[model samples]
Structure formats: C-alpha cells, structure tokens
Target chain A: MIDLSDLSKSFGGTPALTSTRLKIAPGELVCLLGPSGCGKSTLLRLISGLIPPDTGRILLDGQDMTQTPANRRPTAMVFQSHALWPHMTVARNVGFGLRVRGLPRSEIAAKTEAALEMVGLRGFDRRLPSELSGGQAQRVALARCLVVAPKVLLMDEPFSALDAHLRKSLREELKALQRRLGLTTIFVTHDQEEAMELADRIVVMKKGAIEQEDTPSGLYACPATLSVAQFIGQMNVTLATARDGCVAWGGRRIEMPVSGDLTLACRPEDLLPDPQGVPAEVIRITDLGPLLRVALMTPQGEALTWLTPRAAAPLPGARIRLWPRALHVFRGETLLETIQPQRLTLEEDA
Target chain B: MRRFPLGGLTLLTAMVLAMLGPVVTVVLWAFAVKWRYPQILPTEWGLKFWAEVLSRQTITGPVLTSLALASVATTAAALICWPAAFAFARLRFPGRQLLLFSFIAAQAVPKFALFLSIAVIFLQLGLVGTFPGVALVQGLSAMLVMIWIPTAAFRAIPPALEEAAFDLGASRLRVFLAVTLPQAMPALAASYVLAFVAVLFEVDSGLLIGAPKVTTMPLTLMTLSAQVVVQDAAVLCVMIWLPCFVLLLLTRRFMTSRGIAEGLGA
Candidate 1:
C-alpha cells in the first residue's frame, strides 16, 4: 500500500501540490487524471522520490520513505518519453539495476532474458535503443523498469506518443500486464478516456486539488461538480430557476426536487426523441456512423444535444421533443442538485 | 553567372598542390647534399645530411626531449580538460560564464608577455631548467582550446540519456562512465590531437623559462639553423617535421575510422 499524508510541494515559492492526501491499496490501478500543469506529474515524481515534497510524509507498506532517494525507493517510473539509454544494448539496459545491485553476471543474464521475453522483445538483446522503433524502444523501457520488480510502478502518459490504434492495443496489453504482475500502479494522464479505460479508480484533479475520486463508472454517471462533469465527457447544462419541487426552463416548468439557481445536465445518449416531451427544433444534425448527434434549440433559444440512431435521421429544420431519463442539477458552480429518472416521468405524466 | 571563376576541379587540384608543395620541398631538401639559392632544383641528392643529423648527439637528445615533453603535456591536458569540460557542460553555478570566458581569453593573449613573468615564477620555485615546468606551461596554454571543443561535445548529448541511466538504478558516476563518456569519445579524441599539435610547436615558454638546460626540438632547431646555413636549418626543420608528420598520419587514421572530424566539426 502507498500512502501520502499532507503532501505539499513548491517551486520557487509557487505551490504545485497543496496538502494533498491519497492512498492506494495493494494491486490497485489508480489514475491521476487532470489537465496539463495540474500537479499530476509532480505527485508522481514525489512518490517516485525523483523530487522530495516540501512538507509531507510518504509511507510505503507502513514504512516512512520520505527521505529515500529515487534509486533506493521501491518505485520505478516509465517517463512520458520513455527515457531509454541509447548507448546500451537491450539486454544491458534491462539488467542495469541488477548490475547496480552487484548481482552475478550469469544471474543477471537469465533475469534479463526472462524480462525481455515478458515484454515480447525476445531476441532483441544485442540491438541498441537507436535501432529499435519507438514502440519497441518503449517496450525495452518497460522491461527495464519491470525487471527491477518495483513495488509501485508510476507511468506518466506512457502511451501518449503512439498512434490511436497502437495506444488502444498498448492500453489493453498494459492493463493485462499490470494484473499479472499484481503491482500497484499510479498512471497519470490528461486524457479522460484513457483514465476511464485503465484506472480501477480515477482521481479527478483541477487547480492542484482533487475534485473527485471514485470508480470510473461512478465518476462518469455521477459527477460531483460542474468542472468534473465538463471535464469527464460532453455534458449539456440548462439554467433553471428551482423552487417548490419544480424547475423552470424555456417557459416550461419541470418537476425537480431542487431549490435556488440550478443548472440541469443530461448526457447526449440519454436524451431520446419522444412524441410527448419538451418541444425543440433541430438546428443541426451530425451523422457519426452508429450514432447521430442532433443539436436542438428550444423555443427560448436554449441549446442541447441528443444522440440517436443514424437510421432515424432528423432533418436540419425538423421540430422534435427529447426526454432523457436522468438529469443532474447544479447551483451556481457547485453540483447542488440531482433529478432522478422518475421525476422526468412524473413531469411527463402531469 | 557564377560566384567564383575557380571551377570545382581546378579548386580541388589547387588545394592538393598547395598541401603537397611544402612537404615535397622539405623531403627533397633533406635528401639533397648541396643546393644554391639561385637553383630551381637540387644538383645532387644523397642521404648524407640525414646521416649527419642522426649521428650527432646534440640534435638527437633535444629531439627525444621535445617528444617526451609534448607527450606528457598532451596527456595531462586531456586529463585536466575532461572533468572541467564535463562540469562546464552539465552543471549550473555562479561565475560559470566568467570562468569559461577567462579560459578562452587566455588563448588570445600573446604568450611572450606571460613568459617573462612565468620564467621568474619558475626560477623562484626552482623549476627552471626542468622538463616538467616546460610541459606544465605547454599544457596550461593548450588546456582552454582542448576543453572547449569537448565541452561543446558533451553539451550536445541529450540530458534524457543521463536521466534514463539514473532511472534504471545507475549512480551518477556510473551514468557518466557508461553513457556520457562513450558518446563524447570522438570529441575527446579530437581534443587530444589538437592539444598534441599545439604542444608540439610550443616554443615561446620553452625558450623563455627553459633557456640553457631544458632544450626542446624547436629551440635546438632554432640554434642549429642560426649557427649553420639556411640549408642546414631547413634540414633540421625537415628532421623536426618527421615526428609531426608521423603524428599527423596517425591522427588522420584515428579520426577517419572514428569519424571524429565529421562528428566534432574539426
């Protein structure tokens, strides 16, 4: 288990991480998801002991490892660029840690071969990093880190350099590899889709603080803030005056159990075309193979997007109505309200 | 319509002739037994001057002494420049620019002005008339140029390589030894060759501080040329040129195989 307590770091008097606390269970794959420059890499570096925190205590397996150097720590990092030593051969690069630990040459050779095979780089022992393709070099880098058998593996956008197809393939490969190794991993990425796909639990970050931390599905289905909803996926929010279990928007009053200046949010897929629903005009239609994205403008000029089957094509100037099962409501900038699916049905019945 | 009228083939021929002209002249003169100033070519050619110069103890000892001094000085300069170059390339500190500029500035100043003061210092230290003092002076003079070339080479290495080494559980020293130094080998070789050539021709300090006892090949050649006629001086100059010729040949082979010239822009 890895634990961070009141972790804070500053660079030249500007704070990067501010009293952040986190815990990862053994064999957990937790991803730190945030925008660029949001201190996700900084947190990973602090855990790896590449840099020390100005004020914090890092505990690994109940032992304080705050003062330990990076090489001494039982943590390894796969950098975004996959920083492989270009001078050494593949086998030598993989066996570097063993050599540093003064292991016998024969033993290092055996272990290096095994590690190479594990990363699917067998028979590439003699090739230098420069001779390998980017993906091959990345695999060599992964082999180098894994051969050390580190307790915690930290990856900072390890697949960001690959093409979309390769990135998908590598993500699955990495997930399976992590499971087989049973090593606790902290993955950092600015890409939300990648975070949702890979992480058992995602920690959403904004402005150097954790906005929310939950299972990927939970964070996607029930975002706690406007920023979280906005960041995770495309969300349409409508301003509504909420009072007395009723929300008013676009000259139509809907049943909602929220008070104050609330905002309504519904996923595009959940908003379906219905004969008896809120009146809207299709301002634009975008066909996206399996799903069609229809941009709707209410009579009051409020805009919302709804996903429908491509077969059910809606003309650009067509009039329509949309009834989404679930909706989220927020007051001001905070997610202060949630409207369950039954409320929408009750409003339809009334 | 063209920039210069010298065609490529003409330029190539001219460059080759210019390089070979002085070397062929020296070799021919060293073999010639007798030659007058008005003569375009030698009347007689023999090994008589070569034998005479080789047989003489005076010419031979100074030649040996100069070789020993240059070898020791070049080796010492390489050693001193390696770490200094590494530091200048990698680290950030106060006065770094100033320190580097001071090294370059030392190269620009006339050596004669410093030679008088260096001689006094060497006399006070009782290091005058010694080979070590002369070699030390030569090494110090060549240190800046040697270090600057390799420093630029070391700086060209990607910082990612060293960081990668450290990430893979290598210590800082191990990273330099395993990764950094190998990449800088071509530059290091170039620096050594340049330093060797610089030390070989170093005569000002050797003449000033080394006076009567510590005689280098250049100084010996100077005295022999003055006492004897121009032909004898040219013969001595030819004799002196032999070691430099061997060094140049060896360095050419080394540089070509290692691609040091292309790598370091030599």
Candidate 2:
C-alpha cells in the first residue's frame, strides 16, 4: 500500500528517474526490474526517503511522506551488500532500529529473536556479522527489516551478492517470508528471472521510465512494447513492413491488420516446426537442457529461433519449415497487436 | 605450536633487536653519567638528571604542558575530524575532491614557516602565550593526520551499512554513531593516538607562540638537544612515551577490527 505520483528526479542535471503514477496493493510484492542506471534504485530511494524526489509525492496509507526523512518513514530497506553492522552482533544488528526508536531492551531482544526465527537464523543471535556466511548475513538483514514490522519493505538487489545456488535458496526463503508475513515489498533487480520468480507484478523500467508493468506471464505473453518483450525472454524479433492489411516478410505475405512499418517478435516457443509451412534454412541447433533451440534463417535472411524438444531437434543447416502460434508486432517500440495462431499464415520458401 | 622457520626466525629476531637498538640507547644514555666513546653499554649510571626531571626541572613544566595541550588538541581534532572524514569519504558533492585536496595541501607547508605566520596571527588576536592558542595551532597541524586516517577508516565501511541504519529508521546522527562509528572505531582510535603523539612531537608552533610563558615538551626537547643536553632530552623523551605505551595497550582492542567483517566474500 504505497502509491507514487508524478515522481521525477535528475542527478547532476540529467534525468535519472521519471514516474507518472503507480499503486502497489497491500501485501503485493512489486519488483522494479531494469538495466543499470534505469532509476529503479532511485525510485526505491525516493520511496525510502533516503533522497527527496525533485518532483512527486509518496503516499504510504494515504499520508504524503515525500518530505519526511528516512528515520521518520515507516518503510525499511535491505541493501544488496546485506549491510549488517560488522561490529554488532546479529541480535544487536536486528535490534538496532528498535534501539534507535528507544524501545526497551527486553522488547527489542524478544522481537529480534522472533524475527531471526522467522528467517531461520534462530541460533545466530550472538554471532558477529563477520562470522556469518553471505546467505546468513542477508537473512540477518531481512530479520532486521522484518523486526521493525515496516509498512513496506524495500530491497535493492539483495540477493545479487550471493552465489547462484545461494541466491536461489535465499530468494525462495525471502519470497516465502514475504508471503507468510503478507509484507508489501518493493524489490529492485536487474535479473529478469529473479523478478519473474519473486514479484506479483514486475515493473519493467528503461531510461528512468516505466516501460511496462504486468504479471510475469502477462508480460511474457503480451508485452506493451518491444523493449518489454526484448527484456523478458529469448525472443525472435524481426522488422516487417505492414501493407494493405497484410504482413510482408522474407518474400512471403500473410493476412494481418496493416498498421505501418513495424517490428515483429515472438518467443522461441511461439515458433513451431510444422509441415505444410514455408521452408527455412536451419543454421545451428543448441542442446539446451529442457528444450533444443534451432536457429533458422528465413528466405529474406531474418534469423529466428525455434525451441523444439530435445528428441525432435533438427540438424544444423537442415531445410525446415516454421509456423508461428503467436507473434507480437510493434510500431516504433510500442506494441501494435499480438497476432494469434489463427491469424498467421505460412508462406513458401523462396 | 606451529612449525617455525628457523633461519627466517633468526633474521626476524636480529631485525627486531636492530630496530630497538636506538630506543635502548636512548634509555641508557639518559642514565649514563660516565661513558666513553667505544663502550657497548654505560659503565656508570647516575640518577641526577632523572631526579632533576622528576623534581622541578626545566623539562618538568614542559612535559605537563605538552601532555595537557596534546590531550586537548587530540580530543578536539578527533571530534572535528571523524564527521568531516565521514563526509569526505562518503558524501558526493560539488568540489569534493578539491576540498579534500586543500586539507592535504596544508600538510605540505613546512612547520616553521606555517608556525611563523600562525604565531603572528595569534599575537594580533592576543592569543599568544596562551594554552588554548598553542593547542589550537597544534590541532590545525594534527588535523591533516586526523582527517586522513579516519577518512580511510570511514571509507572502509560500506555506505550500505549507514543507509541500512537510516532505512530502518535511524537518523543520520544515529546512523553515524551506531553503525559507521562503531565499525570505524579502530581507525578513529588509531588517528586520535597518532594525532596526540604528533602534537607531542611538534616544536616550532609551540615554541613560537607558547614560549616565555608556556613550555611544551617539544620546545624543551628542541632547546635541550640544541644545547647538547642529550641526557635530559632522552630522559624527557622516556617520560613522554612510557606512559603512552600503557595508554596504547589500554586502547589496543579498539585498533583491531572486530574479527573481520564476515560474509562479505572475504
């Protein structure tokens, strides 16, 4: 239950963040995903009151906290570096916020114990920060935030510091913890897979602007723009000229709404090897664990990737036919429409 | 308990002894009343200078004055430096590098030249021959070290730690006190002690402004050594650092980091 309105920020005279309006529902985990310098972290900092936004308002439960300092805010943040006070013991680290608030020692200790238990770090209270592993440190940071019972939790790439295996386990634990507590959380990360795995809604950001905000599958199935589709998955994007309510590509014509010259893209799974379809030349086949990916060049020299089963993978340089089950068409980065399987027609190879 | 490198250990022992040779000489030379040129050790030792240094001697008042001034300078400079050091190391602002460079640039000025100008200024301000005036100048000279050490110490702490403290509802002051300062305690302690000793070593500024009324240890050591009063100078030197050795031991725990910041892939 956080709402940001008309937020825009500039760093050293260059626009670093721009937001129009965003509403995160109670207990909803929203992920801010983008490349580096995309203003995802800037947005988080603005919300956390670490930095005041140049223009905008942050509403927590309908109270404007835009001008409030971080200490006055009801939100807490878990840093990517874990940020556990190295000199402090785990219990002391978790209790730091409470201590700052002037809470009683007994109460702080009790809450810290409960929080650590929730993160499965029950016996680590007496250990210093330097004594724990990367994952443990992160859990301590989580417990520290959770102990405060923040209205909203902010995490900036909190799992990026760990090994892949540790990251996966920690991410699952974090997600589970958030779900159990029903915490309204804003997590920032550049990892698409992490966003998909953790977020109830993913806010795809580009150049300080929100590109698309949708559920993971919703975004993957129907991206609002070319950038969203390109960012989310392995895709086969090709530029096509739309003419007279028909699509022209690779010396082939297909029935479709003629908007304008546009770019077309689809997931690798969208392209299916089929009989009774235009033939294409397979350039290479990669043996991915779950699916074998076949790379093919259309007659017009556009390369497309098709994911076939490992058992059904075609050889490299093989002449094959591919038909699309669904494909997205975009006009200058904006999504024009997604042409479903029923609307597509395969043309013969030149 | 572990396997010892015998040859390496012998070399290390010789190096340590060689390093302590001058210090031993200073101690022995302070007590020696009769010693010739080729003697390896003092043949006859006397306690005349030691008694004089302990009992109202020219160096007595200087020693006390130096300790008091150094204490004040170190405390004041430490208080001033840590916050500035944190800002210098952490905050990004316009002309940050330039500002830090100005502080370091002050260190490049020779002590005598800087003291000459400072003494003239202090005299006009009616602060000449005053303890506060002398201590203030000592603080300015010591501040270069004060800023540099804690800046490094503060830099070693991840900003995320301070941010995390703030994100969890700790104010900026609370963040510095609770998170940054505790983590940087060792550096702060090291800087404070080094600054104190640095003040004790300063002669030009103290002599220029504090003489004829205030006599700090360095002024006495400087004049004594100039007059070839090596024994008394050596005695004064022992008095200054011997007590500090205890102080250092007491604060030694603060100098070492609390068991290495774990889980940071170290």
Measured on C-alpha atoms, candidate 1 has an lDDT of 0.82
Please give the CA lDDT of all the candidate structures.
Answer: 0.82, 0.84
Native contacts matched by each model: 0.41, 0.89
Compose the digit string of candidate 2's lDDT tens values, residues B66-179: 899999988888888878998889888999899888987889989889988988898899888999999999999889888988888889877787888888877777776676
Task: Compute each candidate's TM-score over C-alphas.
Answer: 0.82, 0.88
- Candidate 2 residue runs with Cα over 4 Å from true position: A341-350, B1-18, B31-37, B43-49, B79-99, B120-130, B151-157, B222-231, B246-252, B255-266
Q: Give per-residue lDDT, candidate 2, residue B107.
A: 90
Q: After the best TM-score superposition of candidate 1, give how far the Cα of residue B264 lies from its true spot, in angstroms.
A: 24
Q: After superposition, how far is residue A1 of candidate 2 from its true place, in Å?
A: 1.9
Provide the clashing-pair count of each candidate structure.
0, 1
